[model samples]
Target: MNKEHKIATSMYRKIAIDIAQSVADGKYVEGQKLFGRSVLASQYKVSPETIRKAVYILKDMGILDTEKGSGVEVISVSKAREFVNRYHEIESIHSAQSDIAHWAQKQTQEIADVIQKIQFIVDTAERFKNSSPLTPFEITITKESTVIGKSADELRFWHNTGGTIIAIKRNNDLIVSPGPYATFREGDIFYVIGNDQTYAAIKKLLFE
Candidate 1:
């Protein structure tokens, strides 16, 4: 309803996105119960209610399911993979729409700003529609990961996995299209683009 509320909503959207990416990266498996509200809130440094809101978003996206006895868990792996392939563009469009709708509700923006937001929404839609088959998924670099603490070249990451790390989200900053010299570290989330074979290799390297 207000600027502060919009900001909070956007933050929750981000939290929801991070969770979906984590699922896609196999950090959280399908049919596996997710972390509790307090734990997730702590991890994202947000309130429990914010975590709930993020979970609600995931439910709406069909990536999460809940029942009385079973509790909360990710949906089928097929659906989860579908979400991973397009969630970024979906988030962009959703955020743009939310911004535009909020501005309309408050009558707080100039015509130019409204146009810019609309263009962003349109551009995101276009990109999503035209995306290639090599859409990337997020993968965290853990201490046990073979690539951890190694440069891409030293590990032959791209060659071995047949995927390229297009982005690295370390802490609060995101480095897009990082080079081979960009060494991996524990806790870094790498955005990797590859095919089914590439994904299998990645999963074997990271999980098994």
Candidate 2:
């Protein structure tokens, strides 16, 4: 809300991204201890307060366990994943809570059932996060080839070629599924899922 809050939020967002990336890349894992506050500060070139801000954000997001004397340690990647899934659930609730509640009141039903599904997804994601399964990669797209949202034709082409678009990264936002027929703009990174040949073809299309 205020300037300081805004700054902290921004820093925490970066930290969250970093932590998620680390876990995804297997740099960190469940039960692994994290570096202390001062250590992180020195590594990231941030102030101790900034590091604290980041750490606290991760703590609230359910990624790290912190003790006064012992310092911070990894709890579970599943917990971190759950944190993200729960955040999405909160967003959905914020959008539909009042409307859903009113509808439920009129219908003499409960919204808890729907909310439970959201919770289940969050829980499942958390569980999987902790397990740290190996993810398969298919292709590499650089900052070139004019990355833009794929047209329906392009999507069809990729699909026909046996390539799957799992996710896309546009700055800090992650775009999943039914990509809205969006055209890829520059600076977009897509995570494709498919076999080796599919990946090679896609890479050739993009890079060569």
Candidate 3:
């Protein structure tokens, strides 16, 4: 890899390790507040994105609770230990109970971090897959309605009823925005978009 890429990757890993160790060592004990992204970014001399990435990793490990608007907080040591114990066989593995407990807590946080990372990827893929086109269709509009004529009440009413006017095809032209000021004229074909229910609602509105 290039020098810059290598350095960035190394820095990212270092940041993750530092956060994990801090949580492990009780440097930022359970329930204690951690700085927000902007604050941490300044403190660590890293970009906001870098701080976000690090915080997200910590959050996945269950070591941190990052609530939007509220800021990040260290998870309770007891709770952190509890989670760690579930993923690993802590009780039977060690005779020295205190050391075992400490190790278990740390291990649990690590596992949580891994799971969170994997889950994020899985969720993103699922969303993309679901968004992929499963089918295609052609519709022709037969009405005259302008955004000004239809008004906010009509647009909202349509949206609330699950009917969406996807596009407006005027003479030799296509207007897709269909914004608040948009309009539909007679012979203007509208490309309505939505699922079965939406399609059904459109048919009802048009026919009725």
Highest TM-score among the candidates is held by which one?
A: 1
RMSD of each: 25.2, 24.5, 24.2
Models ranked on TM-score: 1, 2, 3
How well does model 2 score by local distance difference test?
A: 0.65
User: How do all models score by TM-score?
Assistant: 0.41, 0.37, 0.35
Between prediction 1 and prediction 3, the one with superior lDDT is 1
Compared with the true structure, what per-residue lDDT tens digits does model 3 show for residues 106-131? 88986776566446544644554489
Clashing pairs in 2: 78-126, 78-129, 78-130, 148-183, 148-184, 148-185, 149-183, 149-184
Task: Please give me the total number of clashing residue pairs in predicted model 1.
Answer: 0
Question: Residue 208 in model 2: shift from native, Å?
Answer: 48
- Candidate 2 TM-score to native: 0.37
lDDT of each: 0.77, 0.65, 0.61
Clashes of 3: 7
Q: Which ranges of candidate 3 are over 4 A from the true structure?
A: 76-208
Q: Which segments of candidate 2 are over 4 A away from where they belong? A: 1-5, 84-208
Error of 3 at 11 (Å): 1.2
If the candidates were sorted by their lDDT against the true structure, best first, what order would they fall in? 1, 2, 3
Q: lDDT per residue, candidate 2, 1-208, as tens digits?
A: 8998887767766766577557645688888888888888888777888888777777876778898899888877876776666666886887798888788796553345445544654454455446744233533345576434456356464665565555555665555553537555667666554555666666656655
